[model samples]
Target: MVTRILSENEQDLRLAGEIIAAGGLVAFPTETVYGLGANALDPDAVRKIYEAKGRPSDNPTIVHIADESALKQLTWRVTPDMQRLARKYWPGPLTMVVPRRDTVPNVTTGNLDTVGVRMPDHVTARALIQAAGCPIAAPSANLSGKPSPTTVEHVIDDMDGRIDAIIRSTPCTIGIESTVIDMTGELPMILRPGFITREDVARTLGKDILVDPTLNEKPEPGVEFRPKAPGMKYKHYAPEADMIIFEGETEAVEAAMDEERAERESLGQKVVVIRYSQEDTETAAHEFFAALREADKDKADIILAAALPQEGIGFSVMNRMLKSAGYNVRKV
Candidate 1:
């Protein structure tokens, strides 16, 4: 069994930092989500991230830093857009993909010349990074292919002995990973969408932020091109149960889900309906599924979600929904 401790003091923070300094893994909270962090510069320490999370070696981890100056340690060739975006969104939920330096291990960048980096706003995470004095390569603090843990409890559920220590915190405020934009490409493009939409990035850059159709998973026929991003490829952010996301008008979609729920009930299987944030202000896209977890706390049969509007940040929200649902879309 794993020993679970709630760390909320200076001494515990120091201890957690020490564990990271010594090249051990630490599951700590970030503004976006909890991340499994290890020394980004050390191959051995970085490899532990692989063994513990069972993450694919090809899947790159983001470098968590305390400040912009930390960027010098791992990368260079920063663009003016990178500077503006960094000044605006650093210390929050934004990841900038930039050209890598020789110091960044191949393990951290997935052998690519570019690396995704961010300065997190979470205090414990920043402290650990400051204490360790190096960018910590981290990904969501769960086994590679599961829903990213947004709470410390979820971290404990997925990682305990697998890491050296856990810096627990409340459920993530952002409740989603950063918007990962690749500047290395010809045009600035959003590789993954979070609270920061492509429009936001475009508006900031004074140029159109080109969006690849690959960002959204279309389950229709005549599909040939491949997505150039990571989050677009796999079944991610999924809980133990199965999930489906409904697409169309809200009322009509809800009606479809009610029927889907009835079908599951008739089949003697539990079902959950995930409506859009527009339906309930209290259940914003960020906390929609997390809120429903209690209703299905006993491990229900499946999760079916109604497609959320692309308006506002709901677009990014739906990306996580459909991805987690594993492209489970049904026509009513």
Candidate 2:
């Protein structure tokens, strides 16, 4: 895998931008995580994203920009609440699903009338987008079914000249995907969760954003629930190995992981266990999937993860990990 260390400079940004403009993939950073980017305006370029990630053609990519002006090119309708959220959260870890403009390719919007867009706060990504002169369609810089890469090394390991370049980011600030909300629906709906929460968007809108039931299932067609973004329809951010997690309330999950750990240890099989740790590290939700992904790499046969509290960042990360790992995912 070819890896390039990037400094915040015009030269590297220009190189990455040139690749995007010329219809190639580039991996760059955002506050949330690194993304594999291509020119959003070019369907051919956008198709390369699915090719690189081994992502299904039906699963769309999010359009990322440096500034709010680029949003004008992708979305036809941005509501007042959407504006408020964008003003406060853009250039950060949030993705808004708004009505797609004619310029937005159907592939980029997953054939949905709505499009997913974000203004990444990372200097490297912003500079590259500015130099490229168009919105960049980006998904997590990893294989389609694996965990999202949070570091430059992760991107290089999974996708190296399958892309144009890798911009060495200063480690991901959020260590997960962006919070995705769909304003195109009758009520705002959270398609995916991250650093931004449903409560956070609800507080901004002064009304609760509806949570979709489809989130609990595999990404399949003809499902009864409505979806606005690509992540909603597929499993994502998973590890290479099989991972099973305990669901529901925190204490029950803890006991489940504990019992699984004891049982496996007795069988002499090395196991990786994840439980909520308040003092040892970041919130439980954020670290659980990372642990599972890490465990999968070490050849651990089993991963026991516990569900976190509904409050704060815990809820968002847990939901993503569980979905990515797939359900019927043994209740640890």
Candidate 3:
């Protein structure tokens, strides 16, 4: 199938929406990453997204809405805290998982009664949703388990023949997936980290939030945990090369990465080293996935990445690094 590359204009957005309304797939930009979208209410359309990305059916997708009013269609009830969060973080890089209404297909929720929902800040995304006249269920528009696409070129590399169309736009500003928060419990639990830090959420709600213990730890072997949200039970954000992360003080980590690079190069192996400065955690988060894509493009044999400090948004950046390297790490 030939995939149409559409411009980020009113005419093309309407066309993209029509494709989605007709049960076809459309990849469009969001503040975080490009999302392969389909009508959330259409079970068959949602299935197409899984098939296009080769994503596991058990992993849920986030429903994107144009406004808060769309929540009634995707979720059963909206709590006071949910309202508070929506007021503060809507049209931003944050996802809230809540009880799903019957109208929302089980396929979209990974057979769970809860669905993840977010209002993306991108104007093209909102316009597409409005034109489609339905909530859109979307995951990052990349092949399953690969680095999520932040630019249209990245989306085309993975989804060209596999999807119906793509909105060719600028690179994503956040350059990672949205922070996923489960609102079902007494205390909100962060299943995935992103630009929206836990501190930001807590400050907005005037209550403490919990981080998923597994967010920083390797998954237990031989255990099957059905995820309530994306990135919970999946091996995601990986590159093609064998990758390892070095964690410690900045100097130590850099020295270790340099040593590894020289040793590998001496052995006639191509190596890629990725280490951001101490003060550029936001830049680190923005460029991490793109750098991984570059490594794959260069066909490096091994990738050595310096670990980020685990505080604030740095924690989120580190979380992606760990998953991309499959929890392979060496502390100096």
TM-score of 3: 0.99
lDDT of 2 by residue, 1-332 (tens): 35465656888888788888998888888877789988998999888888888887767678998888778778777678878998999888888888888888887876777788999888788899988988999998988877777777777778876776788767777777888887876898887777888888888778978877665555565655434665665666666556676776556677777788899889987787766663323455345545655776788877766655545576676667667567645543
Best by TM-score: 3
lDDT of 2: 0.76
* Pairs clashing within candidate 1: 147-237, 244-305, 246-307
The TM-scores of all predictions, comma-separated, are 0.91, 0.89, 0.99
Ranking by TM-score: 3, 1, 2
For 1-332, candidate 1 gives per-residue lDDT tens digits of: 25345485777877777777798888888878888889899989999988998877777889999999888777778778889998888888888888899889988877888888899988878988887777899988888777777788777877877777788777788787888888887789788888778878888888988766666665565654333344655557667787777787767888888888899999999777666557443246558546444434767788877776765577788777777777778755
Candidate 2 C-alpha error for residue 299, in Å? 1.1
* Deviation from native of the Cα of residue 265 in model 2, angstroms: 3.1
In each prediction, how many residue pairs overlap at the backbone (N, C-alpha, C within less than 3 A)?
3, 1, 0
- lDDT by residue (82-175, candidate 3, tens digit) is 9999999998999999999999999999999899999999999999999999999999999999999998899999998998999999999999
Off by over 4 Å in 1: 1-6, 218-230, 279-283, 289-296
Poorest stretch of ten by lDDT in candidate 2: 278-287
Stretches of candidate 3 exceeding 4 Å from the true structure: none
